[model samples]
Target: MDTMRDRLAPVLTRLLDGDPRVAVLLAEIGADGFTEAGRRHPDRVINVGIREQLLVGAAAGLALTGLRPVVHTFASFLVERPFEQVKLDLGHQGVGAVLVSAAASYDWPAGGYTHMAPGDVALLGTLDGWTVHVPGHPDEAETLLRHAVAAGDDKVYVRLSLLSNGDALPVDGARFRTVREGRAGVVVAVGPTLDDVLTATQGLDVTVLYATTVRPFDAAAVRRAAGAGRADVVLVEPYLAGTSTAAVNDALTGVPHRVLGLGVGRRELRRYGTAAEHTAAHGLDPRSLRERIGGFLGAAARH
Candidate 1:
């Protein structure tokens, strides 16, 4: 099981060599990974020395010059801290850039809340024309990276976290794929949440839909999978809870159904521990996730 970063980090070299318009904007992260690329393409590979604002701003400026800029940093710095720069420099200016994030959600809980960005996807969703991808595996992550660059100025957000599934699936860009089929209900897993979602719905009669692209929401595919839009829909995300609630609500509008959302909780745990510890604290571990699904669908066994 290759990690998302392991898969994506190499794409920088390919992009630099293949396309002159491609640029990699870094905010003091991934320096070691892109050292060779920076040396080879001195003009395109830029590190702004921990300044998140300048990272986004420079990417936007590069885009203004008709260059395709790929910005990389931790989730919090990439989205939360320099958000205004992202909004105005990129979104407001109507210029396009690809924002790639690692250490997502609580993947770096030891780094504390300052590094935690459960709201990155939700916040970026507010911006228009963003093709958000949360690939469960590295192959998928690499594919999305290539897709974003080939798109030519299409705004893309690639969320690379420490968590990942066991296997890889061929991604069709913005489409969602069925992990398993059933009739009782539908359990939709976004990004790395697939493994836990699969384990939680083992005995339940529900369809599991895996999605790497969440911003586009893929409502049509989701509705079609729902089979008349009646099966209970459960969205299991690795980020903020209820982050996709509105999109889901609107997607299934006028169709009778029940929805359940599970993810990082709203309240801050304020504890230092491993990512798994934070996950369990927020009721996102396998056992807690199973209980939420079981109770909602009325499974006979508690576990």
Candidate 2:
């Protein structure tokens, strides 16, 4: 039951050792995991001691010098805190880097709202030309990480989560993988929500799409799944609710379609609880999802 973060150190260490152009910038979070990598390549592995802005700025600087930079931190600090830098230093400057994030949504509920960033993905949607990878399993994370590193001056965000599916499905890091096929509608599961989505949609007639790469919004895949008719799409993301709803709407443009976006709710829960509790509170648990999905698709579901 190793989380994606558990796989980061080794996979990144291998990447750093094998490629001379790969550099990592950290903001004191997960810096301990890269001790060996820092020792092996002092100039490449850098920790800016809690300066999240500097972490992104330095990564952008490295990218400008023809180096591929992998920046790591919690979702909030990585994307939200230094967002201005992410927008200007990287996007505006036209530099490319790999932004890897941990602590998906409310993974560490005790850490409170400051550490939780359900809006990270939605916030990044404002920028252009960015590739977003939300890996459901550790294996998928490694695969997407490698792809991001070798993207050749393309902006990529590899969002690693403490949550994961029971197994790793085949992910090309470019398109969505169809886990199951049906005709009634399509349930697009982004990253770790695949397991719950599978469970929630059982005994129901609907297509299940597993999306590791979300930014490009695999429109063609959904179009293919929905076929040449009125499409019903349910986007289950692990971030802010309706984060991908607009994208789904845009994808189904000109075709009659209805979309239901489910994920962490906008209402802030003021209690400190386990991640499981948070999931249920947000109506993202399997049972709640079953009811919602069944109601939306107008199909009776069995647990």
Candidate 3:
């Protein structure tokens, strides 16, 4: 199976070649993997060498000089460590950049708590006008990355995860697409969690919605898909728990509704294991999701 890295390499090459003003900054994470690109575009592709803060600051500086900077690193390093630089240097300065993060959430659980960053998306939520994309598959990642780069002067975050869905949905911008219809309620699957969501809701009767873009939240689409009044909303995000709860709540303001947010657990597991094992531990596996969903749907029906 092709990973997001596989798709991103060629797209980066194309992006660097097409746009003279486009540049790439790395914090020593994927320097070796991007050898070919670096060799081709010596001036544009720069390795900042293990300094996350400086990586973002430099990118912001480049953006100020009319260069479109695409910063790359792990989620923890990209958003968590140098967040101040992202907030002050990039956001405060009003310079736009496309931040691409790998090893999403627990994709590298073996890397332990230091590498895991379920809170990355939530932290970015604190900032203003930042577009976030959590692609389910490599195709979706490619589409989102290319689109983000093409969108001039827009601050964007593209999250890349190891887990992939079976099918590729068309890459529409920041809108929730209806996957299935049912009277029970709505199951909104975000990013890589689509496969688990589909499996969890397989036999159940509920409307399913899919979205790669979570920052915008697509409230109108949620309202439309949820039918007329308040409907059961189960948000299955790939990031921290309850990241999109506020947006969903604001969308259906007048209607009284309840939400069950599911994602990586807030508490640190602090154990070394495979990603699958970590997923089960956090009750995010297909079986666990099914049980939680069944209970939520059942309770909703009772009320």
Task: Tell me the tens digit of each residue's lDDT in model 2 across 1-303.
Answer: 777898888888999999999998898899999998899999999999989999999999999999999999999999999999999999999999999999989999999999899999999999999999999999999889889999999999999888889899888888999999888889999999999999988888889999999999999998899899988899999999999999889888899999999999999998969999999999988999988988998842222
State the C-alpha lDDT per candidate. 0.87, 0.92, 0.88
Model 3: residue 74 alpha-carbon error in angstroms: 0.4
| Candidate structures ordered by TM-score, highest first | 2, 3, 1
Per-residue alpha-carbon lDDT of model 3 for 68-168, expressed as tens digits?
Answer: 99999999999999999999999999999999999999888777788988999999999999999999999999999998998897899999999899888
TM-score, per-candidate, Cα-based: 0.96, 0.97, 0.97
Q: Top model by lDDT, which number?
A: 2
TM-score of 1: 0.96
List model 1 lDDT by residue over 169-235, tens digit each. Answer: 9897889998788877788899888888888778777788999999789998778877874657888
Which scores greater on TM-score, model 2 or model 3?
Answer: 2
> Residue 128 deviation, candidate 1, in Å?
1.4
Q: How accurate is candidate 3 locally (lDDT)?
A: 0.88
